[model samples]
Target: MRAVEDYANDDDAAPLDMLAALFEARGWPCSVRGHEVSGEVRGSWAKYQVKGIWRADDRVLQILCLPEVRVPDDKLGAAYELLGTINEQLWLGHFDIWSNGGVLLYRNATMLGDDGTLGLSQAQALVEIAVEECDRFYPAFQFVLWGGKSPADALEAAMVDPAGEA
Candidate 1:
């Protein structure tokens, strides 16, 4: 793993390196593992594991968001339904639950184009979008898994604008 400073100094570093530097510059503690940069981010609901991976050939930056909780077996169906609906509402990322562990994750990506010059601001926004999307839909997962609410109801509640809160 290269130091974040190394990435910061090299304008021609790989996508992963640039992302790590950008994240570090913004005070996010990220470590480069192989080709991915991962860190922990705190959200309104819980802590989330965030990973950034760069596909050099594709000029893509993939950001993944993973929450700490696991979805119970009984709630798998509801969780899947919520993921589908919530994914539709999202503009930048999609929610998916792992089949093996029933763990929900949010994924989004930014295309750096053929030239592979990704601006610092764009990279930061890509990572930020993944985390924000996870925090936004996290309550729906709680509702389905623990509150025993239907997927539709949970999604509705999550989307609703609470009165007098602004």
Candidate 2:
């Protein structure tokens, strides 16, 4: 157990350092950006840039994963609908389409307490969810972004079991 005083230190808010150590220990490469950490993860469809941002004021650690698919202006509506449907299927973090840039980001967060450092398992889970979710859905995103597929159709195509049926 950690002392309560540790929480009061501003360094306690530096989640990137902790995450970087964890990544290094696991032999993963990452780029540290101030209070954030970004790394590359290979998914089934593509590799993603996964970034972790720590907000001290909010006591939250946020992980954002970016796939290769970038939504064009004309496809914004389908992308929005795709996100809405896909988000419901996710048990952890969901996708966010930035309005200005039309960038799709996979996001998840964990609230850090003022009493102790975030547990390694908890920190690990946040990173895992970001990667797994992005890998699982990257193809669906591509379908919407470039294939001219409807959200429902894309999601249906994505959810199909490859080994089960055609």
Candidate 3:
């Protein structure tokens, strides 16, 4: 098992490259964006968006990564509360949330119901849920490369098949 600290210190670009390569290996198309967002109340927020498809469905999975420091404790708490509300409001097909050091990964799941208009509170909530879930599934989260094959396999092995080993 790998420590969260080790994974956290690993290069962000390395994972992005590995993900892109995985997608390419599977013949899936992808787009990656690394950007910084600044706001009056939020100061400066760094975010990376890895958007693409793994299957024939029009659905797109977006992997969001943000610095832990950018997410305040109060905001994170609020996000968790909102996540509960969102989960109650809509049925989540599938999802996972994981964190390494100060970075968090929110991926899986189909787009939010209703044309993706999951208000700020709800969005934050979803992120919180994803983070928590990821922590529960440590090293496995890091194995997810592209086409989401690794994640799918991990979920099936760890969650779906209760009797199976992870």
Give the per-residue lDDT of model 1 (tens digit) for 7-57.
545544567766777766667777887868898777788888888887777
Which candidate gets the maximum lDDT versus the true structure? 1
**Cα lDDT of model 3 by residue, 51-72, tens digit:** 3222214323344432232223
> TM-scores, in order shown?
0.85, 0.83, 0.26
How many angstroms is residue 6 displaced in model 1 relative to the true structure, after the best TM-score fit?
Answer: 11
Candidates in descending lDDT order: 1, 2, 3
For model 3, the superposed segments whose C-alpha errors exceed 4 Å read: 1-106, 112-116, 139-166
Arranged by TM-score, best first: 1, 2, 3
Displacement of the residue 12 alpha carbon in candidate 3, Å: 30
Model 1 is weakest, by summed lDDT over 10 consecutive residues, at 3-12
> lDDT of all the models against the reference?
0.78, 0.76, 0.35
Global lDDT for candidate 1? Answer: 0.78
The digit string of per-residue lDDT tens for model 2 on 42-115 reads: 66777788788888788888889888667888898898998999999888888998877778899887788885
Candidate 1 vs candidate 2: the TM-score winner is: 1
Locate the minimum summed-lDDT window of 10 residues in model 2.
Answer: 1-10
